[model samples]
Target: MPTKTTVPEDHRDDARPQFVLEALREHRHFVMCAHEKPDGDVLGSGFALGLALKAMGKTVHYFLDDEVPRNLRFLPDADKTQRTFEGIDPSALYVFMDMSDRARADDALAAVPRAQIINIDHHLGNKRFGRWNYVLEAEAATGILVLNLIGGLRQTVTEDIATCLLTAIISDTGCFLYSNATPSTLRVAATLQDLGADKDVITEQLYQTRSFSGQKILGRVLDDFVLTDDGICYSTVSQKLLESFGASHEDLEDVVGALRAVDHCEVAALLKESPDGSYRLSLRSRGRVNVMEAARALGGGGHFRAAGATLAGPLADALDRMLTAVRAEMEAERARG
Candidate 1:
């Protein structure tokens, strides 16, 4: 395939991708990673790129200390992900995907030599803490950037690679329902399909199928949903509630997105209790609200419409803090108008 197939004209002048491409060719071994508790875009992008490198006879290690959500286990090479960077070559280059910083991959990866790191992400305000940073906030998913890199190498995207890339685009775009799904995203999706991506498989596994326990847990979250007067819809999912339903954090994967879809809701927040009693707050917004700003204020980061933060919980206090940050972002957006 041609290199220009995925690289848009505006991105051509950005030399970071070329620099990263050179690094990929120079390295004999690599360790690919994504954020802890990763979503599809992270897993898919890592798997696709890792597979491509493997095809070139390069050694690739995928480090993912966290569990792969049940739905995403179908991704190519999903079973190959390592729980630790055990046996990693001392000279292996670390490729961080979808995360703004290396710490998001967990405490261990935080200390890796920055000069040996290749940061590829689509998050706003990325720290650029790597030897080569290919951060493009305008892209809907990191996989798009990976595709461009693969195309630059004149790689033939196999069926598995196409499937993984398509999943990344579909997952990050809410199956193309989110505002971030631009014409370029759709065109890329179309190209992947022509390359033999199984869209039906992706749709069936991600959307059509849902565990009974997950559905029940989602029910519990929505039953006590709170919609604030200013159009912020919020909910809490306690670890106790999850235990009662025999579900894990993965069950709540799409719950926040569902909340954002509610009528009159400009923003949605889900405060979930962790095993250690801390809280992970997931925020989503319809176009006007910049949930990322709220998340950053609370010590997190992501795109403008979607972001998250961690809180020390006595659940109520955490909820209060998250609400306060979100309300402040809402006010800021209104003031901008």
Candidate 2:
């Protein structure tokens, strides 16, 4: 059992965590959720919190709008996540993790009374919509917030909980490669490691283990890659291309990162065609651009270095809109300088 250590100085004065802790202590039932397209940070953070609540003997139900990504399915309790809140306890407190907006959790969550919702997030431009919003924008990941909450509640971080929280931090920080991985973030990760987080398993499953179909899709997307003269790298993965290679959207999860790795690439964008004729855009930046501002302008939101949006597609129109957003942000960055 891992005992609580010194509280991170940055969060020591924030009463939001204490407030959220009280609410969780008061509630007998909880329904945990995150954004629709589940990712490592959201799923791992949600599960860590849910697991802690369950260990306290409270009823916890996990809900998400989509299936867990293949790479993240190895996390404990990943299989138990439900797609709907059907048969949910009306009195259950709703807990939204790693997302700024409730709509990102599910369209149905919008109708739930705001007083019953707790929003825990670390994204920029968060709405703080929860009755108890623990929004620490400077923190590397929402998992860090959850870890603080667990420490505040004086609960031991069991091995499984440690692994889940570590996964959240790892995913959001791009395995500590992203600039967001601050010293405090690394400290939290070290604590989790000491608490027995399986770094080997996480590294193997998240990066090393790639499906054949996923590799094919990656190759195809790279074959069609484009690098604009202005250091904007991009590529498109159409639904037809996915089907031809027998791939799922999960296969392209890291494609944008690959694009972002190119030398001199200031911004990288990958647009994937959806079944509804929309394109899901994943944007990444190398510090020169504020991708979140562009994503927010396009009705999406994330950190400055990584953000996303969905645009209605004729393919050509969607591609144009995405590039326009990136260019605008780049120009804004230059003007700010």
Candidate 3:
């Protein structure tokens, strides 16, 4: 697909740009938010857009429900992010970023006293849950689209903005190692780098650092890792395991990635017990399995290679059911040969 960057500097009939342009025209003071458990993609994209809007002299309230992970604190203006909507005007429009469902925004979104919502996301299963939904099913990350949106708004792309957007793309694409990272993804990365995005700074903060508790949890996961005969590797991060290691949900982000690195592991799954008592499953496929289909079969959504779902626990049974779908998909794919 052609990057929409070279289009004439006028209104195009494209729905994505039209939605963003319309929202900018319609809303002045806006509450920009992300998913409940915020990750780099959502936070980075939301913050980048926030910077762009603020540059235009608009009131932007960056609201996030979850505690920002420790490693991502180096973001230029992330310290200003809010967890509540208090003291802000009730009349502000709400912009949901990197997430489709309002429920994913959690309670922080509930108090927002506006009916107008603009949803910008890159999820395949986004239900178009906004007055204006600018979701791109094929975009690697929302940051990629937000970079285009910044250009759409005809705003200057500052170095700080480039860093935030670059972090979003790198985090979501697993450092451009995931299947979602395409030629266009790299082009965006190259452009961001040219705009002064510091790869060393981002890598130092995100990759070179890991909490002691997180490392302990990784040790446990590796010790108990399971590799089935069918090349399916899985790990567990139950509430009990978390308590034992004094680990937070934030730390398990890379445990699945580590599990995926094992030789001959076609699929890797990390099932963690969420604080809300549901089992959150993060899955990765090394090409032999369609994890997205497996996730959707169990009522979740994401890319073909990386997908996720939160199942109501008892985690044991939910994990079993999810794995059943994954195994079936693997077997079906193998049968296709």
Candidate 4:
């Protein structure tokens, strides 16, 4: 685990300055963005903030590089998300949620050069990549930060906003199962539930739900699971298997989570062959490994336990190299233990 450091506690009243609140009130237009290949937390945090801003009478535009996943389409106002960069006015106040660096901003990075960027994220590896950064590494999710920001508005959080925030919190904290789920996380989640978030509905749609093709692809991946020294387990999903199972990228979304559930697995790896010939690597560690550092070594970044990278090469070579690196890191961690 990464070393924990104490920062100022994030309270609703102390979270914002009077000047920042005045600046937000004066701003008429805002653009909210999330990282590339956004997960539930990124999407949920971005949309929740956008909705809160809109409720404050600010004209808000939500932007994403990739399409929102089908499961998250239930978020209110998701139809308003902008996927293209053309004709975007750079004058708007840019609010980036759950993104660590400008590179992960995808199409919206161009707008960052001219816009006043405010970054809100939970990743410890965040680069503070905004003109105004509000990073809380100890916070369980960016949605928690969004909730704090909304508290400054003094407006009641609606059901839609609550649902979005709930999804973000639940996903990022692995449904409150990950080690990062602090007492504050439960407090925030309980607050959202009181505000009308149906935890059962969110879990059913996000976790229990899976397409037939998705199930088949997951089965295939599990069948191919390989365990190495030090309890590192990995599986590779090739393009051929995807076609044979009538699965697309969406169908493989939960494969990494499934791999993480295997008993005795200290680390889980899922390598998917992208259509562009690059390999998409998702790494999950069970509290003993820092996958973010390993991912950075391969030119990618994310949280400690969950990080990913894309490698350009044959799938076999990429997987072999990643596993070797993981083995070295796990061995070092075991020695430390």
Model 2, residue 222: C-alpha shift (Å): 1.1
Candidate 1 ranges beyond 4 A from true positions: 1-15
TM-score of each: 0.94, 0.93, 0.90, 0.90
Q: Model 4, poorest ten-residue lDDT window?
A: 5-14
lDDT tens string, model 2, 50-127? 899998999999887678888898899999888678868899989899887776777757787877888899877777
Q: Write the per-residue lDDT of candidate 3 for residues 158-245, one digit (tens) a residue.
A: 9999999999999998888877899999999999999999988887877778888899999999998899888889988889878877
lDDT of 1 by residue, 1-337 (tens): 2143332323323335777787788789999888988888999999999999999889999988887788899999999988777889999999999988777886778779877888899888877777777888899999999999998767889999999999999999989998889998999999999999999999888887888888997888788899988999999998889899888887888899889888999999999999999999999999898999999999998888889999998988998898899899888998999
| Error of model 2, residue 268, in angstroms | 0.5
Better of 2 and 3 by TM-score: 2
lDDT against the true structure, each candidate:
0.88, 0.86, 0.81, 0.79
Better of 1 and 3 by lDDT: 1
Indicate which candidate wins on TM-score: 1
* lDDT for predicted candidate 1 compared with the true structure: 0.88
Ranking by lDDT: 1, 2, 3, 4
In model 3, which regions exceed 4 Å deviation?
A: 1-15, 110-115, 275-277, 335-337
Q: Candidate 2 vs candidate 4: which has greater lDDT? A: 2
The total of clashing pairs for model 4 equals 0
